[model samples]
Target: MAAELSILVVAGGRGSRAGQGLPKQYRKLAGKSVLARTLEAMHAAAPAARLTVVIHPDDQALYAETVSELAASARAALSAPALGGALRQESVRNGLEAIGREGEPEIVLVHDAARPFADPGLVARAIEAARAHGAAVPGAPLNDTVKEVDANGFVVATPDRARLRAVQTPQAFRFSLILAAHRAAAAGGREYTDDAMIAEAAGCAVHVFDGDPQNFKLTTPQDFARAMEQLKAPSLADLPDVRMGQGYDVHAFAAGDKVWLGGVAIPHSHALAGHSDADVLMHAVTDAVLGAIAEGDIGAHFPPSDPQWKGAASEIFLVHACRLVRERGGMIAHIDATVVCEAPKIGPHREAIRASLARIMGIDVGRVAIKATTTEKLGFTGRGEGIAALAIATVRLPEG
Candidate 1:
């Protein structure tokens, strides 16, 4: 039989570094306490798993107050708090021992209360890894170079960046393996930072799984300020509403001295054939913007079937789509488009197209990307018969 899973949340730290009227874990983030968010993630990952939340003896009242804000199911999922010791290692040992008394669960996940961004997928991966290898921790690859320094703060060595990883908690372990490891450490009067290290000291194999960049620990005062900014940052799922829309348009070559793309007229032997200026790029962008707001495509707004649009600039269509976004209480986050053509060489015009589109859409140039490619002499674009464009837009809006 596979071992059942359980959780041990260590919330014993004072979080003094985070500067507290309250512990950082108990502080509000996005209108909810950090610990509450952490618990919600844990419960969402494995509702059946037994939960043992460890805290400082003096923090019982604070813990109760925090637990009160959780939903009924979440409150019911928590076991009685385990009183922690002076050291973080001791606190985890206390949690492990408590689980042992209640009937040992086969797998246990030990996590910090400060990292509220723990996702259910990570939790499930940790549990699976631990069950296979007996001990595992989630970690992400470091983007910056790391160094090993002495007490004097002199850098002794710069480690290879490729092999280095910054580890995170929700360290998982097989029940008997971790319990025995912690028991051995306590018996020897030894201590370590995390359960993975303790398991490593006891000659147990430890493994690493991918971790999320957003699952950062809330420690320093600066981190709290950054968290506030992150709450406003782009997250498709966490935001009130985010939608993506795609657009594609094609136009055949016609007799003209210049061709228009993204509202910019470039000297060319042939122009795109369309009721409007035949700016495929602008038309694609317009459709994408319209689709994101769910107001239909460019044809719905300005049909080629309507003679008034004949010889009109495509930029006006794009502007109308953008206006609809504003009217719907939304903003465009990004627009990416690809142009397919063998003629009129898109290399020199790429930046111009992006800039022109940005100006027309009333957004920063950084938010737009215009790329060009050919069909490798395989399609109509390769034969120089027409130009085609594909685009996608990302938009953010208020929830209904």
Candidate 2:
């Protein structure tokens, strides 16, 4: 059987240096909080691992809000937050001890909450190294010459850059070994900067593995700005294919009391007629997403001629379209959708529809835009004969 794994996220710092009047982990990066993104990344890397977060006592409310921002699956993978101690070492120790009580895991990864880019490959390597060597840390090679300076700033000794590595976390270790090391350090009234250092002090031979340069930590205001810039506009080399697709769908009135739009049912005099649940908005959004990737439309994928698709929920179609985008190494950047209807007032359910689409697409609600309008009694929608929806989906795909 594979070894059981757990992850400890240390996020106790007040982030006085980051200068956002809030903890750096709680600060918004892109559309989500840094801590939320970190947790999501960790969950994505190790889907089976149990995760716990160490947070400052004063940040309980802030932490709750951050947790609410995560996707349901990611949030479900998390254990309750552990109250952090004054120092990073104490915070990690608290996390480890808390998880230990829930029954120990074979391997534990101690990660910094400020670092949100530890991809799955890096995490897999860390796990393999820990299992083989008992203790390991991810390390990137130093790119500059190193010097040991005296008190007056004169160079005392020059060190070979090739022999040194800049270490990062998600540092992995055997659960029992690290727990004992932390306990011994606490008993001796000693504090180490990181878990790897404590493991070394405990006479464990720590191994270093390759680390990604992009897995950098957020420490200063400049670092935060750089991270935001990177997210806003990742290099073309990473995502060179940006495409926008437009989709329009319409459904005429049928004999029913409700109509489904964007996965929400609204009470109406008549329902929309279609092979599926007749969610015009969701259909347009799905086709828009597929079109952005140059994939065929809804009919081409889930043909109305297929009996299995009859009466199926439109949410299923949108979910499949989003999955296809992900499988192609692409992401849905944003979705802008407009609903044209005369009978059912859409203003009351605008936010609900956006939330529903966001949940189905597995993206933030901020990336989805839902708008409603009518044709002034001019077209089929204006004639109350049918409802129509138009959508534009923006997506980013890797270069060929």
Candidate 3:
């Protein structure tokens, strides 16, 4: 049954009401385009269903770019986009016809590209309702009182809000039933707002199932802002995998007047000796971050054997480590580092070192903690012969 299911996403509107430029479906919400998020949600709900998008003729380039943003699995679920018509109803008809040519599906679902938050439960309910009644739509009960007004702006009637529902998609249907209804509507020169209405006009019984309130459509700039905030809000139900890693490093004093510590150059009696700028703090932090992701140490990535990194800045290593975390869909939550040294008084430059580390890691200064400690003449660091630093990193990754 899953293999026989198909979905059509309608995205042909100019979206002038949302803004002056760029269709709302193509606009970005968070870091992803609205249409990409919608497609990903639908794919997650019905992995076996064949997905298709209906788009305007002028939006070919934009459509391509949006599809490129999707994951490989989501992209694999999609068929070629069907060219849309002047009206939304006409566009849906074109999409249905295109799906028919590819091979008619037993069931079909029509959804709006601006609605990106549909969950798996809603889709299961939609499929079950369609199978039972032949046509179905998801609708949420209205919360506000509804009124019917006359042309003169006088209240004509106060309808019972108890029976009213605000409808949402994907509206599910048995394939042959809705195709005939749409064909009949087009032939009779009658246009309906949604497929359920057209099915009703064609004498078919349409069922209404419960809908999710978060499945609201994106229609205005305010709606976009709200969606961004909603995505940013952390939920316990989808908590990330938190991890911590520790790193330690030591560098001996060499024959230079300046030393690099946490990407900051400070005047000192001797420089730290290493392949790189030998910023002990930065190297320890970089190793800690890499360890948090289980991606080996800094030497494994940038080996001392490689002469290309002979005089490289330690910031390069830290930046590369952070980039790797982001590439894996993870984030560095916090970093705490303690420098072990008896010289170059770390107290006077603590804030500067913290600020420098934050800028290099692309995180806030508050997330980076810098502290200084001494072994009280009990270790080599107390003898002022070398500088040692230890770091602990916390990271969060998407739960597998």
Candidate 4:
């Protein structure tokens, strides 16, 4: 049976206690907004899960800009925007109602958008447990001794750490059960901190799964700064420097020609229209090299307006990029590129593309790699439109 799950992302909190001007979910963390990262993990766990983001009416502008980078699958799976109510329980009820409008799913996952670091594995496990037992939650084993104190400041019984697990999202449940539970709570004027609590109050048995220690939610200013520092200088061994840059080019598809991608000719009805053979793979690689060196891109070195470069082979662009890197006392270490298109099988010519790029960059063929994937018949490249390529290059910096 297909797993039809819906996600209700609660992002409407004012975060007054956290002292952030914007909601905690809207706060920036690790070079991107927290909500975006949370949504990313959710979509990765179940790409087809219907998404309903509960947002404050005032934060519509912020939501639009921050969620623009979400995967296409995620964007398509979203429900209409639902404005949150006065309390977390009310907000969740509103979100569930919005999702219910579009044919209620068998299972629903309620997640905190502020908890951007939640693992996709945890999400999957929660969903699996929910499927088996109707309710599931992820929790970390308690590490500290717990004590209960009365209002008069008298210490009570100590809770056992072995039996206690601090719970975390995503809390998954049967759609009908949670919907009724949320509505009943809202009607009775009860507000709970988490979905698990809401479920427990309603007498729903929740199964616990392993939770990751690194998936702490960002709440305060210090948490935000620490998350950024973690991304900038990761403690993991052998991580790349992670230099990033964007490249874009337009090429009209003309009739009666085979398209060459990453130096391999594919049996396409039309070729990319451009001067100098319009090889998108080479252009992308050249731009990546320039980006690595902090220099300008393909346009700066080979302008279309320049007569000398008109109709010139794109291999020269790759060759010139290698020369520039060598001039700066650096070497071409490796190049990995992906060609995006919908026509003329790309798998057959991947090897040839790798060899050609290796020759142009003057590196071993093993140092060059090419991959091809389609947009699954969606965007410009997906509709038998022109092809595009994205590339990432790695190089070792010399000792000063």
lDDT of each: 0.84, 0.89, 0.88, 0.76
Task: Give per-residue CA lDDT, model 1, range 1-400, as digits (tens).
Answer: 2228889999999999998588888999889888888898788656678778999999999899889988888888788889999999999999888888888888999999998867554676687678668899999999998999999999999999888778998999999999899989888898787888899989998999777676789999888877777566444453468888999999999998888988778889987888978999888888998888888998888788987567776766786687677556677899999989888888898888887787667578999998899999988988889999999999888798
Please give, for residues 91-191, the per-residue lDDT of candidate 4 as tens digits. 88999888888778899999888787654446656676788778888889987898899999898789888999988888899998899888878877878
Candidate 1: clashing pairs of residues: none
Regions of model 2 farther than 4 Å from truth: 1-3, 233-400
- In model 3, the worst 10-residue window by lDDT is 230-239
User: Judged by lDDT relative to the true structure, which candidate is superior, 1 or 4?
Assistant: 1
Between 1 and 3, whose lDDT is larger? 3
Which stretches in model 4 have alpha-carbon errors above 4 Å? 1-3, 233-400
lDDT for model 2, please: 0.89
Task: List pairs with backbone clashes in candidate 2.
Answer: none
lDDT digits (tens) for residues 119-188 of candidate 3: 6557766776788789999999998999899999999999999888899999999999999999999999
Q: How close is candidate 4 to the true structure, as a TM-score?
A: 0.59
lDDT of 2 by residue, 312-357 (tens): 7787678678777766777788999999988899999999899878
**RMSD of each predicted structure:** 17.9, 13.2, 19.3, 16.0
Better of 2 and 3 by TM-score: 2
